[model samples]
Target: MDSYQENYQEEIEYLRKALAFIEEEVEKEAKNLEEKKSDLIAARKDMYENTIHASSDFESLVDINLHSMQINNYISSYNPQRFKNLKKMINSPYFGRFDFIEKGCSEKENIYIGLYNLMDRNTGRVYVYDWRAPISSIFYRYELGEVMYDTPAGISRGDVSLKRQYKIWNSKLKYFFDCSVRITDEILQEVLSQNTSAKMKNIIETIQKEQDIIIRDRDHELLIVQGTAGSGKTSIALHRIAFLLYEGLNSNLRSNEVVILSPNTVFSHYISSVLPELGEENVEQSVFDDLISEVFQGRFGEETRDMQLETLIHSRGKTSGEVRRQSIDFKGSRVFKQILDRLLWYYAHRLIPFEDVYYNGTILATRQQLKNRFLHNEIGIPMAKQLKIIETFLLKKVHPLQKKRLQRLEKIVEKSEGHEFEIKSFSRLLAIRQAVAFRERIRKFTIVDYRDLYMLLFKNHGLLLKLARGLTLPETNKEIILTTLQNLQKGQVHYEDYAPLLYLKLKIEGNDVVSGIKHVVIDEAQDYTPLQYEVFRILYNNATYTVLGDIRQTIEKTADGLLYDDISEILNKGKMIKLSLNKGYRSTCEINTFAQALLGEGTQQGYASIERHGEEPKVIPQETLEAMDRSIVEDIAKFTEQGYESIAVICKTQGEAEKVFGRLKKSVQLTLIKPRGGEVTKGPLVIPTYMAKGLEFDVVIGYDVSKENYVSDFDRQLLYITCTRALHRLVIYYKGDKSPLI
Candidate 1:
């Protein structure tokens, strides 16, 4: 595994030879041009000379207009096919659209010509160059070196270096100078020239460097990267796509296979720009919530993700109503998962559920149809084998449909008697194949253990199995069928567990099941439940998983669910790469400290977390509910007083968040951050904890921690999540029980 630079050398050599050959041809053409071609030749020759006075190439010296003309005119002399190919290269859809796409090598390989004039539209100067040229290395890396180019007067040298890798677009590179190649902006700019953004393309590009290392590691097919806020996790993932493309894996690896399950749809659009910068199209960007919604839609009839997260965030912390909170906790805990495990065993042995029971289109009639199936030595057979036998029985039932199909085939064959005679055996084989396929399809209508499904759905536990089973009943039949169809459409559905998503902590330690994928990367992994982790580990079959998260930021803890858990302990694989990001560039230092203290203690500080100095947190304590409403209204005086545009009224629960949000909306002109809103925003907002999870604010007014809200165990995590949403300042006023997080 050589460095990109080393690989660059090998790839660049062949390119240099090709370039020299083109240059020699250009010189020859310059000689053979008709006498009228003298002006064009002299212009091409002189453009390079003048631009080179400060170290430039012919293309670097021309404007877009001239460069286009130059390329069109010169290419006009080549074969029609070659000329068309050249034009295609210049206008390829994928080129320059994304960093990864532009860098990805198409069938054209590295074939490119030395266009004497490709111009920068902004500067009106020729600056286009093929990426394979020696100077293009600056596009991928920061370099400092000088460059040497052959000239009519002999060798020309220029000092060059790069300030940043990303900002080097549309610049000429000068990497070769004084015999040895080195990394430098001066050398790179002089040797290679391309146009790119300097302002947005900061070496300080908000993405962290270590994340870059993480993304580029080729061996990691499933890198579970858990990055803290502002850790550049998304940014690095985009860069990894580019690295993969530049490394020639683009052909085998598509942008689709590498998927990213973002927190929300808004976040997906927010982070879509980076991939294109590397010339790669965006991967299949989606939110897991939406994906899940698609899976369970119709069956669940639009179960809202916001509502789920809201329920989870509202539940975590409590100081009162201990018993009620504990019940909520247990419902979402490993004990529940254990119960699920028991239920799964029962289902496997004697209670599997079925969505439909249509043997030959008529209703299955009764549970007896499925009960009898289990009585047929199904226990001794493997599950797949049992399915096979069920298929055979269903095929016999569908034999009538096949007879009709066979009649149709016979009619068609009779109409083509001459051809049928010559292809009788072939037609017979085709008929048999089609009959088997149709029989297999008809078997899909039969359900195995429909009784078990009904029990789970109508069960008293009200668990996920019930939720899943309920989808198959008469009322839910169409919905469930539609959802299953949706899952089939995406090609990613895998139905695996019957227990609480958490209960298999130890049972799967060594159980071999589905052949595990080599790597497992869980995004937003910190939000996963303990039982979910247990199941996830088994799903990966002991493959190394990179779990990235900030424990204090758990936004979806059911009213009593635990906010903090040990990933290393739960995962049971101690290959932990702990990353602490304390400095949040999104907020001022004053905000960071308050948020740090807001999470209570010891949970603060990390890899890139910085304290951006700014305003102290503003507290708005209300003497009465009426006074609180008026106070919040009056506080929107100006951005100067409290940076009102950056202010937020944080609520400990979704119900509470909605209450104050509605009140504030009617009382004042305060703006609220919509659920899953845009990141680039400025306004006074009243937001729920889960909705505000990945966002930041300048000033925050903590709403309440009454026993009805934060006093519950689940509200603890919600409280922690809400307080940390502030970027600069935090303000808290409690009218009841003190927040456990505080």
Candidate 2:
């Protein structure tokens, strides 16, 4: 018997013990669940029967109170989730272990880490520690040396004697390694080499030191991560959500309270499974367009972000495209935001009509008094709240005056010629009509729809010039105005217009803020504009934000993507920290190198790649479109035969993808990903570059990289994003001449 055999035997024995304990715990929890169910049913029956025979309201209230107390007790005490966790543990108990000795203690503790903690029934010995526990930080942060971790009490100092990692499945240990470093490349290399999946995987056992720091960071309210492509920014953000929920850093933090704003619906579904794999519920996943739609409430025909990008991609060099480009640029700029701010000031101060609140013939609140209250008295209050206060004040003043006028009207009706009952009925009807008219006048004076206010600014060019405040307008300002007015006349709102509209709605209404959201995670942050960030800051004002993006992957040609300084200034309400993840993890060394070369020098200074090797990206030039199509089909078949599970033929626009998919559907089975669709599917997929953002494939085929398609500097980011989606293979096919970017 050698050391290997001895260790195997020990592992098997421990597995048996852990399995037995988990089964026992599952049984105990099952019994508790059944007992609670019975109790709950009995309590409901007792309440119903007692309430039916109650003599008075007090007696019924007593019965209801007793039932409510019973229900609360049951809900608090009974947790069937314990059984689910135990069942999950029976398959794979733990993944890593560390031997640690406290500073003054001679005995060492073996800390086994898993998704959830398990304890011995009688002796109260810990069988496994939850990976999110404070002590488990050592496994990700330190090697075999002096280490310390923060706890609720203080810091715990210890010396790590040994660190070990395991790969266990179905209660069987497949492999184990003893390492002196924190997270060895041996494990990461194996994990990274696996085929890409439709859903993302949780990287608990392979979290790097830097990633660990981000996962556990609770000090900063605004965390901005500018990671390169394939650097696990999305993964880090998801895991950080799980960490925040587990730590309960914000007293009773829940998964739903953490909102993740993904780039698209497909990307949202791509990351939906990460939290559940870590034994946490999925957080709220949404896109910016969804938020915009919610705010606008289907009042206008809105264009999606993907639709906007698609239009720009397909409409190069054309007059309408240029006008649309300028429109998006100006609308998404800080100058536009300033103009909107000035417009808001005008609406609040100058545009709104100030009239006296009158009842019948007398004024209840004078115009001067109302203006003083709305403008002077409530200087710092929100416009919506100030309007509300003025309404309430006007109503209060009208009540007494209204009663006196009605009494005088009754006297006049009695003095006139009429039957006794007729006089009474006539007086009552007159009073009702007068009261309704009075309230209507007050409502008309106090309430203003902001949408109309927005429309006014666009309709009146003189007003726009006054609000521009001498800022340099875009050269295509007239075209921008014309296009916007045309869209507005057709009851349509362009995607670029959503941010400004949302900003105005939120600023004036101030009722759209969702106070329940505690943490906000904005993925693909580079695609967002400063105006959009401002809207986010107002909407989730109470939430701590985690923004993740890669500036190099920004493909929105209409506007400059978010810059570090711009975001820092917009979300400056709390402590803001910016971190960068430069190492490429989702791509091979060859693919990363090829993608980085597209950006030129100085861009690769902070970026590094792992030791994964693959064939260099192939650039194939074709004589015609037919040749390019055939080449793409052949490569797809070859990659499929090579055992790649997920393959994509990415194009520059939806129209191109449709044409390619139409041509190839007969030869091979394919999934056509549209700009507006549900979850993304695996296997050979034909998708536009905009739709493929924040997704990875086992093999990617760039269908068209010709000089005609990618001719401008604006197309650089689109080309870069299209190339970096490949994990194991990348092939670029061009018709006629290859792109100058090559």
Candidate 3:
């Protein structure tokens, strides 16, 4: 056998022995855990039955506290995650191995790399190192030659003598590769050839060098990853979160400290299992719509992003179309964000005119006194808190007025000619009580609505012009601003206005930065405007950001459709690092080639290199809608017969998706995916292109791919995104002339 094969056999033998040893340790630990679990349950039951009564004895309190501490320690010690880690490593001890010699060292050190580290108990030596270790960088980065890796101490210069990859399954070696340069397609091809499931797979074993750089980036405050479709950007992002958690063990960062903002609810659910599969807990996952809904908290009728896109798409030929588009663009820009900030600063200092509070036709507190208290008092605190101070001051002034009013009521009750003295006295006292309660109720100010606050800023043009001193804002039309304000007042904010409104709210009510999130991962970042980034800055100003998206997949156009460069400008310009992933592994070679054609030339840098090959996509031209529907249903049957379980019939809008589903649901069992459809099932799905932004299917049928439907640049991107969702088969049906972009 060759030297490579021999080494592979030796490694397999070592892993087998390791697995045998791990099995024994697992059994021992399991038995011990069971015993401790019984003791823990008994202790908990005893504590529950014997409640600690309130006592004055300090000694008894100390004894109870110590007893609780001891029980907690025993409970904490019973955690068998170490044994669980060994159990996980038994099937595959390691996926990579590297031989390296430090600059001054004469002997080479052999390092095996895995998801988690494993140690030799007898020798106190590390048998396997975690993939995120500094020394393990050589395995993914360097060839069998001179190499270097960064460490906490400094950069370590080394020479890589060997680089190897292994595929171990169930403690058996399936295959192995000894590479001289980089990891070859022989391994990646096999990995990509597998069938994709409903959930995203953990790609720790198959991360490429380009992806490794993105995953291990530590210095940049804003790390923007602009990758092509199916470039494993999302997977690399999840792995980066795992790496951060692994590296930050000594620091304050934890798994829950990281948050992931996905494009949609379905996309969030699709990638929910990725972190857990990588042996890390799942981070917080949410979409922009959900976050907005959460921030607004039902105060406004929030519109889903898909619904906004629908309005923008169908607004053609309408007179208000151009105005609406201009309004969306204006609201999403940094200039508008600046306007809101200036408005907040202006409002913070100037106290608005307050209404006088009166009781028994007498002024309890004049408006001038309240205004003086609001304007001349503390200026740095939040408006809500300032309002509270004003409320307290007014209440204090009312206390003296309340006393005087009660005395007068008592005098009138005693002197008045009433039938019964007790009844008259009680009636007068109740009137005094009601008047005092009314004064108290008036002093309690209602909260300012976000929508109203946003509109108030937009309506004041003179203040807006003053705020636009250092900034260049486009000439604003009075009509458009009024229309926008009218929409806001009606609780129907445009998609672009949502972020700015939230940002204004954050500014007025001090953004509580004590929310312990340390990192935020925004997927499908092309849809995020600078205003939204500003909102993130206020919400998580201290947190690191990982923004991942493909410009070609951006569905919203009127709102800030940011490319990588635009995003860099919006974030810290020089402090941000931009990375690109050009290799696409989600779809087959044939499918990617067809999709790339839609972008035409000048899109070479974003072109993805497909690893797997499949049948060329079939384009069918039908004369009528009925014919197209029949063809799609028949094709779905054929694909199902061919063992394709996951199939999607993609349309341009929800309306089209509903129409197709109404016809197809009778013939097949399928799910019509909506924006709030939290899960993407394994069977057939009828979905709009925008809703299917971050999901994939084994087979895809373009319900309609006509030029009339996909005429704009954003429409073409939607087409490209939906077409690339197919892994094995892709079929497009158009009623009329095909789109020129396609």
- Give the number of the best model, judged by lDDT: 2
**Candidate 1 wrong stretches, greater than 4 Å:** 1-204, 226-251, 265-282, 300-305, 308-389, 393-446, 449-451, 454-522, 530-547, 555-584, 605-608, 640-646, 666-682, 705-716, 733-742
lDDT of 3 by residue, 408-451 (tens): 65565555535345554676556755655664565445244456
- What is the lDDT of every predicted structure here? 0.46, 0.83, 0.77
Candidate 1 lDDT over residue span 1-742, tens digit each = 6665664474346334433444444454445555435656666776555444442555555654464487457656533322232332232211110011122333211212122223334555322343323333323332234434333355444433322222222222223222122233343332212122111121212233354445445544334454455444544555555545445443365554445546665455545665654455635654545544443344324434565555445333433223223333443455455555555455555544433445435754345665467447634553434655665555556565545665665566556656655556885756655565555444453333322342343233544445344232233333333443454344322221222311332241223433424334455566555655555555455455444565555644441113234445556654444443343444455655655664455556443454345566664445576677767666655542643456777775557766787887886666554555444344676766666665555556777655444554346666666666555456677654555555
Comparing 1 and 2 by lDDT, which wins? 2
lDDT of 2 by residue, 1-742 (tens): 9987887788778778888888888898899899998898887787777665545688777877878798789878776667788888888899899999988899999898898889986898998998888899999999899999998988989899989888998888898888999889999999999899977888887899999988889889989888889899999998898889988854588988899988888888888889988778747888888877777887878678888887887777788788888788788878899999999788877876878677767777788888877887435666777888887677667675654664565465556535445555766657655665665677676787666777788888778878996798888887777777777878887889888888888887785447689889999888888888888888888888888888887766433334877888988856988898989998999999999998888889978999999999999889988888788788888888888989999998888889999999978898998766566787899988888888999999998799888877667788898888999999999888889987
Worst 10 residues of 1 by lDDT: 93-102
Which residue ranges in model 2 land beyond 4 Å of their true spot?
45-56, 356-360, 400-444, 557-562
Model 1 error, position 47 (Å): 44
TM-score of each: 0.52, 0.92, 0.87
